[model samples]
Structures are given as C-alpha cells and as structure tokens.
Target: MRVFTVLGPSQAGKSTLVRAMAGLDKEAGQKLEAAGVVTLQPFSFMGEDWGAIEVAGGAENLAQAGPALAASDAAVVCVPADAEAAVLSAPYLRKVEEAGLPVFLFINRMDQTRDRVADVLAGLQTYCAHHLVLRQVPMREGGQVVGAVDLISERAWSYQDGKPSALVELPDGVRPREVEARGELLEALADFDDQLMEELIEDQEILVKEIYDVATRTLQHSQLIPVFLGAAEHCNGVMRLMKSLRHEAPPVEQALARLSPGGRVVAVGCMGELVKHLGKSVLLRAMNADCSSGTEMAGQAIGGLTMVAKGGNGSLAMGDLGRVVKSDHLRLGQVYLKDGARALPDWAQPRPATYRRLVTPVHQRDEARLSTALERMGEIDPAMEVTQDEATGHALLNLQGPQHLRRVIQTLKAEFGVEVTEDMVPPALRETITKPVEIHHRHRKQSGGAGQFADVVIAIKPLPRGSGVTFDDCVKGGAVPRNYIPSVEAGAREALMQGTNGHPVVDVAITLKDGKHHSVDSSDYAFRMAGKAAVREALGEAGLVLLQPIVKVAIHVPSVFSGNLVPMVSGMKGQILGFEAEQDAAGWDLFETLLPMAAQDELCSALASATRGTAWFQSGFDHYEEARRGDFGAK
Candidate 1:
C-alpha cells in the first residue's frame, strides 16, 4: 500500500482535503471540519489500495507528526491560496525535503480567491529548495475561480458545485497563458535532461509521452514539485488529484531506497504497542521484503500479521505496515531482519532539554511506578528526558517545552494511574575556596593499653575555576609513615564532598607539609582522623565562595524579532555575543550569549511567548562562576 502524509498549517483545510481525496466525506463544502489529530485511513482508487495520514495543523502538534512522516511513502503539503498564509508551509516543507521524500504542493481553498495565484507562488518559492512546476493554472468566470487549465494534457476543466470537474474547451484568451506555463514546466524538466533541453532550446515540438516521462523522473527524484490546486471542501478537482497520484506519484520502491539500501527486509517505526489477555503486540511497517504469518524474525514468531488496509487481515508483504504479538525484545524504531538487526536512524534528533520540571508523586507510594512509567514513555517518545538529580534528590523531567511536559504528565495519570505534581527545578549550586590557609591538627586518644596519636600540618589553596580537587604530599624525611599517607588523602577527598555551604567543593588544592606518627600508637585510622580534622579547620578559616553554573546559549528565530532579542537577554543578566544572518534559512537569525543557569526558566518562557512559539534555543553548561551576593543569597 502507498502511504501519503497530508501536512499543512492550522485551518488550511488539510483534513478536508484528505477526506475528499479518500472519498470519505463529500458534502461539507466551505465549512471548518475537525477530525482526528492523527490517524491512518486507507482508500482505494482504480483497484489500488492506498493510505493517507492526516496530520493536525499548528506548531504545537508538529513534533507529534514525526512518526507519520517517517512511515509515509510520500507527502502532500497543503497551503492556502493567500500569499501571507502560504509562508507557514516553509518549515514543514524543509522537514519533508530533509527526509528525502517526494513532495507534492496542493493549493487548497483556491475558489475563495482570484487573480493572486502568481503572488502566492512567488511567496512559496522563497522557501522551497526544489523548482515548483505549475501543472495547472486557475480559470476564472465573473472574477471567481471556476476552472483550471491542465498544462501537461493541454486540457481545461470547469468545476461544478459538489461534483467532479468536467472537461471543457480552452476558454477564450487563455491560450497565451497556457502556452507560457507549459513552456516554464518544460524548461524546469529540461534542466535535468540534455535531450529535452536541446529540444526546448531549438524550439522543437516535444511529445506528451516524453514530457510525462521526464516529469515523473524529476518528481520521483525530488528534484522538482508539481503544483496542483483545488477547493477540497467542494470535492471539486479531488478526482483529478487522485488521478495524478495514481499516474505520477513515486512508487513504494523509491521510498524504500531512501529508507535503506540493499535487499534485506527492514522495519523502521512502531505504530504502537498493545497489551491483551493473550500477549503484548508490536505494530510496525515492513519495507523492501515480505514476512509471512508463520515466519520467525529475530527469534520471535511473526504472528498476528496483517496489512494496514481496508479490513486487512492477511499476511504482511513488502511495503506493508503490520504487527506481531508477544515480542518482549522488540522496540519502536528498531530495524528487524530475519536474523540480527540494527536501529534505523532517527527521523529527527531529540531537541535538547530547554524546559525542566521537578516531578514528585503525590501518593508517595507511587514513586517507583511513576519512574517506571516515565521510562516506558521515554522509550516510545525518545524526546522526553527523565533524570534524577543526585545533588538535590529531585526527579527532573527535561522536555521540549511546557506543552510537551504537560502531555507527559497527563500520560502518567491516564496510562499508569500514577499521579504526579510538577514544579520549577531549583538551580544547582557549587562551593569553592577563595584564599589559601594553613593549619595544624593532632589526633590523640588514650585508653590505657594502647593510644592513638598523629599530627599533620596541611596547606589549603584555591585553584582555577573548573579544576577539580587535587592532593599533594610534600612531607620530607619520612615525617609521616608512607602507609598512613594514603589515609590522609582519602580523608581530605571525602571532606570535599560536602563543603561548609552544603554543596560539593571543587577547584581546590591540598598539600600535606609535615606530620608526626608514633610507631606504636599511630595507624591509618589515626592519620585519617587527623587529615579530616585539619581540612575541616582550614575550610572554616578560608573564605568560602558560592558558584553558579553558566551556560552557552544560542537562539534561532526569525529576524523580524531582532529588536526584542537584546532586551530579553539583557534583562536576564545574560551577556549577548551579537547575532548574524542564518545561512540556508532565509529571513532567520542566530543569537549567541552566555547565561546563568538561574535565568534559563525565565528566558525560555519569555522567548516562546514573544515569538508566538516559533523560536527555539539550545544551551550547554559552560563553567562555574562566582555568584553575586543577592543572586542566590551567597553572602
């Protein structure tokens, strides 16, 4: 079965287009219709079984559509005929192109507008990497879009209200425009074919058969996009779309080639996992090779296999999405073969955790259950990060944003029956010494039979930031026994784990200068005690400094918001390193700076709000820097 993903901005009639094309609903013209956010529905046209994934619009749900895009054979990007609304397709188009999938541009809601087709096409050109060849030009009557001229067949069709388009003669004064558009289409195809270029350059006639072949080859390779238009709500031009797809859409083998090389059968994504009284089942799509119902793969029975089509319950074959039950080792996104297997490359890398929250189970007894549920969820989503902060003893959940975390929290309650509360994570702190100090400590004990006695003099000094704790033995002439020296260093290191400020001590150097050990009484235990006491005493005298982590941050956003960038960064006490034009992405800019970890929460919230959720950022821990007196009560 061939799977085509339908993508568009919110309210762009993507769901309507899918319904009309699939012959699901036909009467609801010119009204907003809400459908499933994500679903796979199979339809038939000319005895060919096909499926369409209708992805809900809006930026919030964009990340959720990754699975649909990865599983599809090709994609249809829907956009409105309005010039301004067409720009929303840029980001989505970039993703489809990156996946190496064949793309077809469908301009929806064309009947609502007239005489602005060229302007809308120009706006879309700024974003598309492939050349867009106009397959049809709009036909207007009484200043209303009534029909379109098909460039390839040199035929004109007029739309009847609520019915299939009827073929009509080329309208008067339309031949000049039709010839121009056809010429443009031929020129684009010629760029990839030498013979075609020669023929077009010499003003020679080209056969329709040759033209169709070149167009098919160019589109299959994703070098060019053939643009189609229709107002999907009226069902007008839907049949034409189905016809084009049947005749021109790249075959499933092309999708398999882009997914993996070689003749081996493979599976990339898990549509879902199900648990029943019988066993657990994993649904997956098989590519390039077929597996029968009784076949075994990776040591598991390929049972319960069925093609994802109209009432499909047959054995899975090449280019079919199906499922198998009771495979404990199977996982989503794992490539399966008859023997061993490997993992498929991720469609999109998990974005760095820009948002963090502290999660605690409300029932207290459900903590373990919550943790297990989070791990299972992470295995499926891969984008949600769950980690326990050893320093603060809080479970931190790292996700893309507030919306993402909200969904995770909801899943915890709905799926696992584990209730949890989320709050802002506090900044992690560190402690360091600011000055050097010298001290002498003696450990002594007497209990009649034996006594413990040890004396040591040590010097504590500060090292450069980021330099961890180090120990130096400067004892001369065997001032202290060598056997007991290791105990002294171990004691000092243990004390560094918890500093005077209740945080890990770092970037400090300790030197053991001189010490005394009695042969009869002195032992490793005595020396260790003396060492610990010495470091503790010296730390009290040394000036303690609280440190805060700084992060290197980069924000990628549209250049139109450049003016607000500086003020936002400066308000968070972040140092801006200036911004420049972003390469490859037009009208975008990259802002760079160093920001304290304490400012991350505020910065993330503000940037998302200001940019209407379009901007995104990445941050990494840079180094520990001294904190101000009022920043976190350091003094």
Candidate 2:
C-alpha cells in the first residue's frame, strides 16, 4: 500500500482532482479518461488495496491524512498555478520528506493560465534539486489546451466532452511551441539513463520500456519529479495523471521509526526516538503515557526515542484516517513491539500546547459542539490543548503554525456548528528587575469596624535567575505575629507579580525585618497589609531595573543563508553566533546564540519568509537578563 497526498491551495481543484482520479462515482469502476483523447485504466498497483483516500483542505483533514500518507508508498502533490497558491505544498512536502517518503509533483489546473511552462520548469529545476523530472507536456490546438502528450509513452490524447477518448495520433495543426515542448520533455526524461542518452545523441529511436524503467528508477530515488499537466476541472489530462502515478511514483517510504515495547513504550521512527511526524498523528506516547484507545488520541502517537534498525517500505490506510500504499519491501510493524508496554507516571499530564486566539459567536450558542471539536483536536496534537479564558471566554487553541491555526478555524465552521475566527495575538510578555531593589506596600485603614491597622518595614532583594519566589520572616520578638507570616508573604508576592516595569518579577528574595501588629487588630489581614506596605515602600526606595527573558537557541542554517541570517539576526538586536561555518548534505550550519523571547514577536514569520520555507529552527528559554541595567543588556 502506498499513500499519495494531494497538496495545493484551497479551491485550486485539489478535491476535484482526487475525486476524478479515484473514480468514486464512476459506474465503469474507476476508468481513467482524458479530454477526448484516451479512456485508459492501466494497472492498479499498490499494497493493501483499501482504495484511494481523499483528504480535504483543513487541519482536521491533514490530521486524518497525515498518518495515512505516512503509512503509504507515495505522495502525489498537486501544485497550483497561482504563485501565491503554490505555497500550499510546502508544509505537506516537508512532512513527506520527514517521513522518508517519495513525492511526485502534479502541476494542477493546467487548463487555466499557467506560469509559462518554461518558468514552472525553471523554478522546479532550481529549488527541487532532489527529484524534478518532467514526464508530460500540454498539447495545444487552436491556441487552447486541448490535450497533452505523454513523454514516456509518446502518445497524444484529447478530451471528448469531459471524458477521455481512445489514444489518437498527434494533431497536425499546432503552434510551433507545442511540438518543441514535447521534444524538451523527452530530453528531460532521457537524462536519467545512459542508453537513452546514447539514443538521443545518436538520433536513434529509444525503446519505450527503457524510458519507463529509467523514469521509475529515477523517481523512486527521487531524482525525477514527474510533472503532469492537466485541468482537474474538466478532467482533460487526468487519465495520463493516473497512469503516471501508477508507473513512476515510488511505492512507499517507511516511517524510519516504529513503536517498540520493553521497559517503556518508546518511539522508533526517523532519527533519535522522535518518530518523524506522520502528518499530524498524535504522538502515540505522551508524557502522560497511557496506551488505551480511550486515552490515546485519534491521530496521537508516540515519538522521540531511538530506533535500532533502518525501516523498510510498507503501508496501512485508516478507514476514517484513510489508506496507505505499500512499496518498500520492509515490514516494520513485525519488527516492532506490539505488546509488553508500560504506562506513564502516576502524576502525568499532556504537554503545554501553544495556540492562536479565536472568538466564537456570542448570541449564537454551540459551546458543547465547540468543546467536542477542540477536544478531538487533542488527538492530532496533544499540545493542541484547548482553553477558554475565564475572563474573556474566548476559545483558544495552542497551535504550532499559522497554517495549522487556519485549519482549526475552518474545521470549527465546517465540522462543528460553531462559527469561529482567529486573531493572532502577541504573546503575553513580562519584564523583570535587572538588579536588586527594595519595594514595599503599606496599608493602615482605621475605620468603624474593629479598626484594622498594620505597619510593615522589610528589606527587598533580587536573587539569581530562576530561583522563583521565596519568603522569610525574621521577626525576633513578635514585631509581627508568626501566625500571620504566610499572609504577609502572599501580599508581598502579589505586588511582585504586578511589577513597576509592567512585567513579571523573577529571581527575587524578600525578608520581613520588622512590623507593628495590634493584639486584636493584628490578624493575618493586618500582617498582609504590613507586607504589602513594606513591598511598595522598598520598591520606591530601593533602585529598580527592568529584566527580560533571554532564550538560548541553536539554529542550523544553510551555509548560503548564513550571510543573510547575520544581518537579519542583528537587526532584531540578536547576537551572531560566529561558529556557523560547517555544513552538510542537508546544507545546515549550527549557530548558538541568546535572544529575547519577547523578540520572538513576528520572528517566526520573518524567519520563514527569509528562508522561503526551506529553513526552520527551534528555540527554548535560557535565562532572564537585566535589560535596563548599566551595560547589562549587551550579551
């Protein structure tokens, strides 16, 4: 069984293409028809024939499609003609590459205005250095895209109404470029083998079988990206598409890792223990490590462990999740641990997932459905947890990316009855003290009821980073009652959180030196007042400075991107990690530097835009720095 994913921008005819290719409604049982040219159903080649599974355009669709595709033999990417729309394939392509799967590009909507086939050809040649072989070119007649010729088969097909007809001879009345296009395609396909090279060089006829074999080999190794020209709308060139997928696309690229059992449930995919993301499957094993179906997420699975062996090709297609096509001869599940697993620790919970903000309708009520939908998302990504802010009641999902965020909103409207929209919110930021400072809070309100009164004088100090809040009461004789100590700490801590710099306070310590407490009036409430006063007073008297979080990041940049990254990083007040000279086949350089987490504002967009989707990196918090101190801001 092999998995073929159809990737393209929304409404780029991807859904139409898949429906046409699968022959879902055909009474003739899945025949490949071209525009008045060919009615052909070649061989149906794939393992575990659960049939073609079509995934729609949405996050949930991706979640369902990901594992299915990951478990498939191949992926057929539908590239859109619009420049802006062409980007839809990027995320799916990255996911396929991570899964060790082979991918083929099918330039979609060829009937519409294409970006001069020469330009599309050139772009693919430059960026997709892995596998970019052109297998077919459009056949034009009367200045319209009437049909196309298969480069390997050397046959022309035309559309009869919407259905394809029998293979026909090449039309004579055609523009000069159409003939030239066919010759160019043949030359591209022939470059994969020496025999074809010799034939083309000698001006001799090359055997058709030889071309197919070479193209298949090149494509399997990802040396060929078979470009199919077609309008999925009219299903004109779709027959040839189905044929190309059957012959040239690789059978499967197995998940480099699998699930194994022993002392603990471990991830066995890709490199390290991390199972490369099979689309958006929930990690099988989470920190809250339970494997029961009720507890396990729908798309959720475990990753982030080591694999002892390289994977072989095989596939599985989930019914609701979709189907997998088999290609590689390797049987992975057999080698993995299907039993003898363990569970997570007693105190286990899912990881903290990030999300963008969403606002559902107010007058319209469907919160039950909204909650169910959000909970279902948890299966695809455990981190994609949901939370409704208490004050705002806003539906929020911690998402990984902008694409993921958009998909969630669409799912809400389409799947659930809730109408939801997203607004990318700037992450909540905090400021801390650059240096130790004395801050105090005082309160003495003597009114009618019991005459409440309290006075607290204490010392405020900052500790080393990450120590967290700690409080001590050093009242020698009973200046402040010992029983009210916890209350005082609470009051002081509260003031710290609402810092003068308008950021959270960190790495600070405070000591309650002395305070006055009345016999009847000096209750916990009185001490709380005293502690509050002391904190506010210390803050006013002791010098204060602003502090910010500094995140240590190790980025791998392609050597070519280093020069560009230098200026970009520095522009955001970032330090240039000069030790980025090394690079490999992945074309990566290792850079270690510290950046403000706050600087992460719009940083993801800038990085992706700069790298043109070819580069990505990870970041984590290192420590907090005194931002407003004397020269302390410099790294």
Candidate 1 residue pairs that clash: none
Error of 2 at 401 (Å): 6.7
Candidate 2 per-residue lDDT over residues 1-635, each given as its tens digit: 22355554346577677666655225212332211111222113322221343444432233334433433456666766555444345444444444445567777776676466656655444334354556666666555666776766767777654686357786665335555765675677667778777888899977778777877777666655677777777776777767666666653222222221232232211100111222222212121122222222222332222110111222112211111111111111211123322222211112223334655653356767677667654533322557775435767665545766665666566555567656554333444444455444456677778877676767777677778777887777877777778888988887777666555666668888777777776677777766776776666555556666677766554444556667677776677666554332233566666776656545556665665544445577777666633332322
Error of 2 at 69 (Å): 1.7
Question: Per-prediction TM-score, please?
Answer: 0.89, 0.59
User: Model 1: residues >4 Å from true position, as ranges?
Assistant: 24-37, 58-60, 113-115, 141-144, 173-177, 273-281, 292-294, 445-452, 558-564, 578-590
| Winning candidate number (TM-score) | 1
RMSD of each: 3.8, 11.1
Model 2 residue 115 lDDT score: 61
How big is the RMSD of model 2?
Answer: 11.1
